[model samples]
Target: MSRHLLLGVALLAALHSAYAGGKVLMLLQSEKNIDRFSSFTDALTAAGFTIEIKGYKDSSLKLREYGTWLYDDLVLFAPKAEGFGGSIDQQTILDFVDSGHNVLLGVNSDVSEAMRNLAAEFGVDLDDRGTKVYDHFHYAVKEDGKQDHTLIAATDLVDSPVMVGGPYKQPILFRGLAASVPSNSELATVVLSAPGTAYSHDPKKSMIEPPALMVGAAASLVTAVQARNNARMVVAGSVEMFSNDIFNSQVTVNGASTATANKDFCVTLTRWAFQDRGVLVASNLRHHLLGSEEQPWGYRVNDDVEFLVDVMEHEGGVAKPYKADDIQLEFIMLNPYVRVPLQHDGQGTFSLRFKVPDVYGVFKYFIDYSHRGYSYIKLTHQVPVRPFKHDEYERFLVCAYPYYASAASVMAAFFALGFFFLYHK
Candidate 1:
């Protein structure tokens, strides 16, 4: 089927498509406890998302219709399904994301290979089949004396406010397997990590050797990835964590009972994944002379120039100017000639003033901002730098007085020699 893919569009293009409550397509399993995630779906709806739920094997399921994408975001809640129905498949979902859409994937202990493949494509490696995360030290106490130690009360969240919204005051109940995220990956961020004493292994089997696969904080329970195109994806280990039961249940960590913070965290995560928060777009990139607004055709060596841009963060269908102190600009040719931090005006405008280097060539104004939990923004504007014209040079200079005197003396001597020759003849 033909797809109207939105590639190379401006950063605001995605936001504009989602400003009027973007459509979300959720694929779920019928046999599974679908009713459990009502709280999560309700939260997404409350946050201005038009959700359309479909069974994993629904024949009518289609991501694109009439050569246009039908949804702006997707939710994969059927982790055990081997493959999707109709025309939906792993590549279809990938293509959806490649076009700058969003996805929220939830996997369980019985996660299928297809789900693993999808997670792997986003740089998250799910543990082997039949294995689950075991946190004996921080396991939540069940009501009926069940000794299953897989229900973990994870508290090791990434220390990023933009990702998690804020510090989680209470523990999040996570009962699922563990995954690994690349430590050096700039696109992937570990949202939740297993406790230091946690390990992943087959609960039914005995320990033959120490668990080497995933252990401690290295085992990630939740990870978020923002692709280079600014498409967002959240890989969650436990689909049950979004259930209404877990959302309303209480979690005990170290014998202290506290209400689960899963609802708040899940809502925040959904909001981020669906582009309701932490989305940034830059506009009106302007550069001109220091004292004038008109941009010249080209810059001169050592010329003073001013640069300005507006950056806005969209949330709750409203756009507000982004405020930050670390946004920078790079004046570049083959290498950066000037790298300076822009000053914000309390609104969303960031401006900078600097003198052009004493070299003449092609230059570009580059802004590459990538903050945790926020959409990536890269803007570049190229302009030429011309050398001084002949008339532009100074007619007289104190440093060249000696050379001027020498040239004048030579001319006078030649004229005197001609006069002497004529008179002697």
Candidate 2:
């Protein structure tokens, strides 16, 4: 009976693992070859994600009907989406993603206006319908020994481990459009960028008359944004990179040819987007008196307090501390009264010691960390601040002895003068 029970428990655990794997919802073009995404699907499956693909025609505006919450990620790869059917408009998808779910958005030259509008709403400025990004000088050479100027070899990857993770074996292939993210957007960060020789224009048009709309490093080939709620969105200018041919293609620059980084790039990108990696989870936050780990409902002014947080970064498996650098802490009233750098001891715990300000009021310990390509981390702990106790006040001070003596002498003289005046009267 014990053996049977153990077997039953093991079976249940396997079933749970299958159900708990990341689920994906992909909206693709019905006209395109479905086999084109065979490798993409395989990669996702290898990463433990179950994918569900539906054509725009079949997709419904009623996203809840398809269990949006049930899915962990959404991939919008419909470049030629003329219009969405049912109630699944741009806002519907955005609202779904805004609920702390992730999305991987891909666009092309034939990108529909609806898709462009959606990109704009996310602060991603995509090029016009017919325009494309090209590097006149750095274009990849084709297998035919001819330069394909339109197939740009983008080498400017952002220096972020949470995004790219490791050294890419080769540059990613960008054969599509370009975009720009709002400069003021704290959530948006460029993941891939075109080289200084790149420009955006309509290939069919006369190039001599029109200036390049986007030039140099200003052209954003790919970008990612982490919303205030820690939801991530990865926007790519090209969908071809996910195709099997491109994923396996060799990149030729000048006279040299080597295997491309397309496959690794896409897989890593998906992992980051799905929050399997580059996700920071702060838990088990504890703050108390420096010496006594005792936590009180409130704290006294001028007390030395200590703050500690267990900050772990999530990657496919167990979460561990992202002990990269100094995290920040702020003691805030109406305004920030104290700001200090948190130190970690090579463990998951981050801590800092600071003296409570003499001025007492309601305050909060605020920790806001905005790491690019990672989820936003904001923690606020409220603890009221009370003034020092009556006994806490100084009874005597060497510096103030002169002032106390002068006050005593003035009182003595006042009494003498009062007696003299009474007697004379």
Candidate 3:
């Protein structure tokens, strides 16, 4: 019986692992001959994830029948598909993203309206003046002095260790043709851009006039969006950037040739988009008055209070301290009563000290810390301030001592007169 019970428990554990729901579903296009899905899947699986690739042309499978949440992540490699099958439309994809799932959408040189509208939802304009990107100044010069505009290289990556990787000893270079424009919509931020030497134009046609958009002023070749709910999306103009051909290609820019695989960039970017990196969390947030073990229900005026926050990076199956420079705090009561900058004292502790305001009533000590590339930390401690009690008021004043003396003298005179009249009568 004991052996049977152990066996049953082991089987249950296996079933739980199988249905863990953290798997990634890659939706690939049938028309495209790209087989790089296995490479990306392998990387994610090696990092302890279960990935499943599904081609849209498979008539036996239905996305709507798979239920609301078949996977935790979705990768759209089906840019050329005019539309999706099995209840997977624009609204379905948007709802999937809005439900806190990660998405990696790739746009080819020939993009469709569905992909364009989806990119627009994230504030990225794939149609920049209705032309492909071609750089004259940063193009690769052929042996005969002709510029090659198709296989351009970019080495300027965002210097964020969390988004890219820790202390990137080597830079990532990309060789492909992709163009993007900046997003003017709210809550969208650009991540990477081309150098000033690059510009966008039609490859098939000749340039009659100067290009309308330049490199620096243009949006970004590769952009990432972090939604309000912490759901992430990485949109790239080139799907071949993740292929083994480009991943193993060498890039030479401005006489400096470097042989580096695009795999590093792809892996780091995918990890970031899939919520494996750049995740900040606040764990233990505490506040109290000075010299007290118990958090006070109320505070007196000018009371010294100390606030501490334990910030951490929740990634890689470990919760570790997050040491960063851009975190801030605010102590607010009606408006911002005190704006204090928390200083990390070389430990996991972020703390600050300030005297309580002189105003009396219910007030809150607030810490509103929001930084780019990190999760926001908001904490509030509701503390009531009490006015002075009856005995707490000033007992003896110099100006009021004469009034006290006069009242005492009158009382004494009345007592003496009453005693004398009674004895004489």
Query: Candidate 2, 358: how far from true, in Å?
Result: 0.8
**Winner by TM-score between candidate 3 and candidate 2:** 2
Model 1, 1-425: lDDT tens digits are: 22334353544576566653589988887736557788888888887888888889998889998779989999998989999888899999999999999999999999999999999998899998788888778888755556558889888988877677758778889988789987788899989999999999986889888687599988999999999998999999999889899899865667777788899998898888877888897998998998798988889998999999999988777888899999989999999999999999989999999999999999999999988888888999999998899999999999999999999999999999999999996
Compute the lDDT of residue 70 as modeled in candidate 3.
70
lDDT of 2 by residue, 1-425 (tens): 69999999997577445333478878787736468878988888887788887887774534556554556788888888867766677777788778888889988888888888888888898988899887887878767676778898877888987787658868788888889876687878888898998888987787875454478787899888888887788889998878887887776886679777888888888788887777777887888997797888988888888889988776775466788575789999999999888888788889888889988889999998876676778899999999978898889999999999999999999999999999986
Query: Residue-wise lDDT of candidate 3 within 1-425, one digit each (tens)?
Result: 69999999997577445323357877777635436555656777776667777775555433335466776788887777778766577787788788877888876767777787888887677754245555555544333455566555655677676776644433344333344555464445555567666666666778887665545536377877888787888888777677665655455556656555457777777777777766676656787888875776777778888888887675644456778666677666688777767787655688888887877777776766655555556677677877767887788888899999999999999999999999986
Model 1: lDDT equals 0.88
Against the true structure, what is every candidate's RMSD? 5.0, 4.7, 5.7
In candidate 2, stretches whose alpha carbon ends up further than 4 angstroms from where it belongs are 1-21, 59-62, 66-68, 209-212, 403-425
> Among these predicted structures, which one has the highest TM-score?
1
In model 1, which runs have C-alpha deviations exceeding 4 angstroms? 1-17, 143-147, 408-425
Off by over 4 Å in 3: 1-21, 31-34, 57-68, 128-130, 140-147, 166-186, 217-219, 255-257, 394-425
Q: For each candidate, what is the lDDT? A: 0.88, 0.81, 0.68
Q: After TM-score superposition, what is the CA distance of residue 331 in candidate 2 from its true location, in Å? A: 0.7
